[model samples]
Target: MPSETVVLLPGTASDEVFVRTVFAEPLSQVGAVLVAPRVRTLCERLTALDNASAGHPIVVGGVSLGAHVAALWAVRNPDRCAGLVLALPAWTGAADGAPAALAAKASARVVADRGLDAALAGTTGWLHDELTRAWHGYGDELVPHFEEAAESVAPTLDELRSLTVPAGIVGCTDDPVHPVDVARKWAEAIPGAVLTTTTLDAYPRALGDAVQAWQRAKG
Candidate 1:
């Protein structure tokens, strides 16, 4: 609707190159710009989008930590957004036992112990098959990207309670980094949020379906 411009933000250890190759190709047909801001905070990224669009209806979305940022942005700028598309949203709160936090801690350990190379190697295996291959090819640059993402967003749950945007959440059943329960909580927390599940094999399908749904609703 209204010539949607979907700004896509990638999760930790990800950058615009990955998002463009993985997500933008399919999404661009719908007239989405797929704006991937390279910033340290969600607020700053949203500010950049604001300046770029100059007050247009934007559909914000992302993966993992990026999703968390998008959700926060939607809450803060409800009127400026058309919809939210969250894929593998991470945990954000005092809930220390959430899968997201556990994974973050585990990843932190990997980075600390085995080093970034080993960490990336291990994680590349755990990612979806497509992503794993892509990451493997880009292994040389993966660590730096992950380091930048880790320093980008500081997860805080209290800040999420303020969001009230229509959202669509997509997650993998086998993804330990983005557990289903955590995704469910995010869907429940945001007003008019919808949740969908997929296996590692169906990631692209899930993403396309979610984006289409959000676009239709925005119309």
Candidate 2:
């Protein structure tokens, strides 16, 4: 791996704290100069990456919505891509009917009609906590972002097939939203990409292990 620059983006309703759980300390120990930039919209993420990559190519990847955005970035900017690490991709193309998108749409409605606090209180489980943390931190723009993300289109299958950078992908067998099959297809599409699967609870570890394995194979 040597010394490399890696920036892993967070998923929708996710923050830097959450993203770091998957790729910070471990990668830093492995000599990766990490830069986890916080950008709100998909456009912002791409712009930030472009700005950050002015002088050097860097490894870029993310989870769920972030993964969707990162995939497109890699396909469009192959020359600036050192590697990729897509994890838990939600869908390909415009996933209007995707449960994750539907859920976001519905949540956006709740937040819009009621309010962030009201909607947050009504929601339950780990998702509830995650949304609370992410949305609240997002401030008033959260609802609109959620609404927009709900209908966001993914990079076409052709885009995925066109990526040639070294890639390491991870998926959770227990996560229905980020289907393991989609992850498998992504791995198969990207040239020489490696795939790793684990339970939802073990995804962070799986991602670390997968990246290490890919680096070993590359070496």
Candidate 3:
């Protein structure tokens, strides 16, 4: 049997480095062609994946806005997707009041008004480093993606219930930005979907583990 191709996406304002660093190892165990595109809009990301997959069945996954986009795409192209791995899902349908969305909106505002340097300075603590590392790699173009991604919504509960591919949902238990409840809701809605609740302190290793297991089992 042929190996499945995997297109892992990064969160808002993040570049290929983030997703590649988090997923490259385990996904290699599956002998997958891992493509991480540097796109801002949902349509762009999906279109990039569509081109990268080269008509080969693939496992699609992403973090935050990326995760939301992956789920939405999987639903629209079930046969094209072999599996899904959603990490730190921001919100279900509308991104209204969601912590991640609000933060993205605020960052976009700062970037648009004060500029990227000021926006980077506004972040504090571990987030300061995390945001700086990803945002720096992206430069100014990432700002628009932050705003657009925050406004983008994933599939609804009804749509999730109709998903055919196996899904692996991971959420940070203590992260207000990406609620664990949202992950649980997705797991419940998608038949045979597995959910894992992790923490920010642990980084996204749990997400990688969950995806690896899902691929092994779902295969």
Candidate 4:
């Protein structure tokens, strides 16, 4: 596998640090350079993808809302996208009532009405830790960013069907917010896209699965 630049974005309210932890090692194993852009809003994430693709076709990917953004970008800019590594796709099109969207909205409200610590109270495990770090990182922009993500739309099935690049979609069967069915739908819609599943506790393996799927599709 030749060296390639892979631009990966973090989930809604998630920072580059988390994205790096998820993809950096797997990408390194394939000699791919991982560029985890620090993006706080939808516009920033899209802008990062656009800027990264200026020189060459690059693999674009992300988790949850980030995955939705990446897929939409690839659908519109197929020529600029070498491949896709979408994980935890939350919804097919409009975010109306989507679990992830609702979760974001609820969290936003909690953060707004109470406070960051109040919103995070009683949360434990890796997700809690990650959110603690990322939410604090957002500071004043956190609520607005959450609202933006809650209102955002992902690529429609028809739009996804138009994508020509090889794609690797990952899902967690136990994750209610980002259903595995959504991931399967994405794989089924995009031509030659591959689907893989992993538990939340073992999500790091999903990146490698996605990369391998992309390679298999390319073959």
lDDT for residue 89 in candidate 4, whole number 0-100:
90
Top TM-score model = 4
Off by over 4 Å in 2: 122-128, 203-210, 213-219
Clashing pairs in 1: 92-157
lDDT value, candidate 3, whole model: 0.79
Q: What is candidate 4's TM-score against the reference?
A: 0.96
lDDT of 3 by residue, 65-127 (tens): 788888888888887888887788778898878888898889888888888889887667756
- The candidate that wins on lDDT is 4
lDDT per residue for candidate 2 within 3-70, as digits (tens), equals: 88887787776776667766776676777876778777777878877887898888888878888888
Cα deviation at 22, candidate 3, in Å, is: 0.4
Which pairs of residues have clashing backbones in candidate 4?
none
Candidate 1 C-alpha error for residue 135, in Å: 8.2
TM-score of 2: 0.90
Per-prediction tally of clashes: 1, 0, 0, 0
Please report how far candidate 4 places residue 96 from its true position, in Å: 1.5
* Clash-forming residue pairs, model 3: none
Q: Which is the better candidate, 1 or 3, if ranked by TM-score?
A: 3
lDDT tens digits, residue span 1-219, model 1:
456677877666555555665567657776766777665444555566576556687788877767766776666676877778778866665435555555555666675677655655644332545445444554555544444444444335455555555667776788776777777776666656777778776654455555654554445
Task: Give the Cα error of residue 79 in candidate 2, in Å.
Answer: 0.5
User: Where's the lowest-lDDT run of ten residues in candidate 3?
Assistant: 210-219
